[model samples]
Target: MNQTQLNRMKDGLGFIAALDQSGGSSPKALARYGIKEDSWKDEDEMFDLMHAMRTRMIKSPSFNADRILAAILFEQTMDRTIDGLYTADYLWEKEGIVPILKVDKGLAPLEDGVQLMKPIPDLQKTLDHAKERHIFGTKMRSVIKEANPEGIKKIVDQQFEIGKQIAAAGLVPILEPEVDIRIPDKEKAEELLLKDIEENLKKLPADTKLMFKLSIPTKPGFYSELMKDPHIVRVVALSGGYSREEANQMLSQNSGLIASFSRALSEGLNVAQSEEEFDQTLADSIESIYQASIK
Candidate 1:
């Protein structure tokens, strides 16, 4: 479908995650922590050990890209410090990949919880720096935590001011609100969430595009129903631990993107794990959706 004709939505149904990546830095032994001079020049062994130790963390595939990408807007200084934001920043540029960053309503600027965030230039600067680094996506997770409509409006408004420039760089601003777009028997959830969307999504630039991300196995026609809401441009069905076969079967039934945490399936990476399951999940997902994408 053409860009204008395509639903502004580009999010695949849901995100596939195994654990919280932000809990802490990659573990290091105090021996290696060397207070400025161990010259553990057996550096080769230390490197091997470090690789073996943290293999579990980076093996997930999606973890590193996702974390570094979040620096686009959130205050991820610690992450930047540990990973060298600029180095990590430059890698995604060559890949043409813009990873999605989900945020609950609490992290939003328009709410009471945001009282300590001043002028909020931190997020904008981060995003701008990412743009300079050559990133393409500025994605955020959305949620409705406030009963006040004005508060939601404020949140989206601030997000727009911060993210609009990123879009100018051909980087899309994805507002990934974590809610069930379709509630079969329970219409109230959809109603309430849509209400929040309507109030908060006002006054957007004409060039701005918004897409919603939702988990699957919701009510049967839940996806189509969610599409009925004008705010959502497109919908992506996410698979949580659903195997390649199952997820492909699901994506075959739809017409949107098939996203997978394929990077996590270290099997394909052939790193620490034995060759069990390759990163075929990502391939299968993209193939299934592409096939169905054809009339």
Candidate 2:
């Protein structure tokens, strides 16, 4: 593991940029960027456009280490190049931002009020490649739609089991068991989630550290205890479906948790904008999230 990168992640004052939208989510991301379904002919071209958007975001002046601690990338993005350097290398070498890869295949069908991650076949190979390309860590996600104790426990167990494998491969793992923000019993679900994650943290190996990406809780500071856990490197909040203004407002109420936003971070950016307009929009987004993170 890169100790310096780990330390930065643990103590950094900024937020993580979630640029890892996969095939399932890329169309919506592209559409939001002012590209529609008619623009791309097939899957490959679709992904290429998505990559172009990510590349543009990374190359922007505001997407630097000062207010951006790290970026979570899709596997293809990690494999691609930015200005002649591999994506991960460019992030760390040129911009001083750490790079983390999204390793989950996506989610399984919702069962028992939760959706576990789909199996990641040949995960070891992916981890090995991430290390070779200068990746500092990995992020995987599962979702909880209600307060089912059994389902939440299963999700946490699977995440920690996979997290152990990631740790064994010499990379930190950000285990995201995101509770649905719109669920009727959101607070109950978060309560159950907190218990399950706490139990798993107790069982984790002494040397294995983990990060968490969760929905902003219904109750402010609800995750404060988790932030203090010795085995937890950091606890971050996902924007889930919140608007940038809403997400930032909630994030500022949680003193210790930082942001790891996808759509919210890209909200206002569109392909039609001029280069100057695009950069200014991105800079504004970064600044708002950065201020919320430091609160």
Candidate 3:
């Protein structure tokens, strides 16, 4: 483990950039970037285009450690390079931003009002590859759509079970059991989710520290206690389908929680923009997110 990276992750003042959109979400992501589905004839081409978009963001002047603490990458992106250096290496060595890999194989069908991550076969193999690529941590996600105790419990349990494995591999894990922001009982779901997380935190070893990527709570400061837990490294909020403005507004109301946004982070960016235009747009987005995070 790189102690310097770990210390930076523990004390970083900026937000995480979720550049981990995978197979299922890539088309939508590209569409928002002004690339249509017809632009690529096959999966390989699709991924190439996606990688290009990521490369552009990574190469941007505003996408460094100054206002971005870390970046969560898709496995394929980790395997690729930016400016001749491996993506994770470029992020850490060149940009000073910690790199985390998204390790989940996407969500399973919604069940019991939640969607747990599908089983990850040979997960250790993936973790090994991430380490070799200079990744500092890993992130996996699950979703909660309703306030069902049984469902939310399952989500947290699966997250921690996998999180422990990530820790044993000498990598920090950002456990994300995101509560759907638009659910009718969103606050109730958050309450139940908090209780389950607290219970799980008690079961971890004393030295095991974890991070969380969650939805911005309906009640401001709802996660204050969780953020203070010794076992918690940081608590970051996902945009969870909210627009950038809305997500930032909700995030600023929470004192310690910071952003780990994907769509919100890439919101004004487009493939057709000139280099200067793209950089300025990205800079504005990062600035807004950074301010919201620090508040």
Candidate 4:
């Protein structure tokens, strides 16, 4: 992240994504990662996590500079039954806040049994569902990640359909292309993939935010092609899976904004005994991201 990037992050929309789980893994994963509470099984524990998460956000004051503060969500993880969705600022037509609902494979059919990894048609359905249900962020919704070029096209195609239908309803489609950088060399692959993204974005909604999730061989060069596109809104570098520093560095490089996961979720792994644990996490997440915004 650079000074300019820092400015952009502090001044624009940003978020930390959440897991999309529909299994025991939901609770177990949060716990395994130490981000959950023993009360994960107990209502009090669930509420505690929620309180901590939200308090953290408030303390962080993410919206102070007009930045979008939120827990991004994937289809599998959007199950509100647990402590996840209740803390959302945008649920049910609320204002100045909203959860970034991640449109995962669940919205679209795929070759695999899993919904989190497949491609979906139009992400508008999720946005609409949020509105009908009065979920916050009533005016917008964002999507992330398609494994490859084909997946990118699938996502853009859906956004295009929604774009054409905006008069009837509206949603913001975010294209998250998970970039697996080839440390030593893989320019050809990088170019090939970024090219597809550039071309697709040209035909999608003008409001669409394109994010590049790059890990190794860190540099904007990996996404050199896409970054050059006039419409690309943000380029985020993520190492995924457990390295909070990786994400922080990615955001810190530009002094950009980041969404914490591994560590936040890790709280659940320690077997939270009660609500206090959950409350503390939320309060921490909000503060953590706030710091990122200022960094």
Q: Is candidate 1 or candidate 4 better by lDDT?
A: 4
After superposing candidate 2 on the true structure, give the runs of residues whose Cα lies further than 4 Å from its correct spot: none
Model 4 spans with C-alpha error above 4 angstroms: 1-10, 17-19, 22-28, 33-68, 74-96, 106-125, 134-168, 180-189, 205-217, 220-239, 255-257, 260-269, 273-295
The model with the greater lDDT, 2 or 3, is 2
Provide TM-scores for the models. 0.48, 0.99, 0.99, 0.55
Q: Mark the regions of model 3 whose C-alpha exceeds 4 Å error after superposition.
A: none
User: For candidate 1, lDDT tens digit of each residue in 223-295?
Assistant: 5655544544554444434554555566555544433333122212323333233234333433443443321
Sorted on lDDT, best first, the list reads: 2, 3, 4, 1
Candidate 3 lDDT over residue span 1-295, tens digit each: 7889888888989999999999999999999999999999999999999999999999999999999999999999999998889999999999999999999998999999999999999999999999999999999999999999999999999999999999999999999999988889999999999999999999999989789999999999999988889988899999999999999999999999999999999998899999999999999999999999999
- Residue 139, candidate 1: Cα error in Å is 1.8
Candidate 2 lDDT, tens digit per residue, 1-295? 8999999999988999999999999999999999999999999999999989999999999999999999999999988998999999999999999999999999999999999999999999999999999899999999999999999999999999999999999999999999999999999999999998888888877888889999999999999998999998999999999999999999999999999999999999999999999999999999999999999
Structure candidate 2, residue pairs in collision: none
Q: How many clashing pairs does model 1 include? A: 11
Report, for every candidate in turn, its global Cα lDDT versus the true structure.
0.39, 0.95, 0.94, 0.42
lDDT of 4 by residue, 1-295 (tens): 1233334433455543443332323554545545635446675455445444433433343333244433444442234433333434333123244444555443434422111234445656765774444332211122233244454455445444443443235333344433333323334434544565556667755544344433322453354445556555444443345354445545554544344343433333233444465446544554554455345
How much lDDT does candidate 3 score?
0.94
Model 2 clash tally, residue pairs? 0
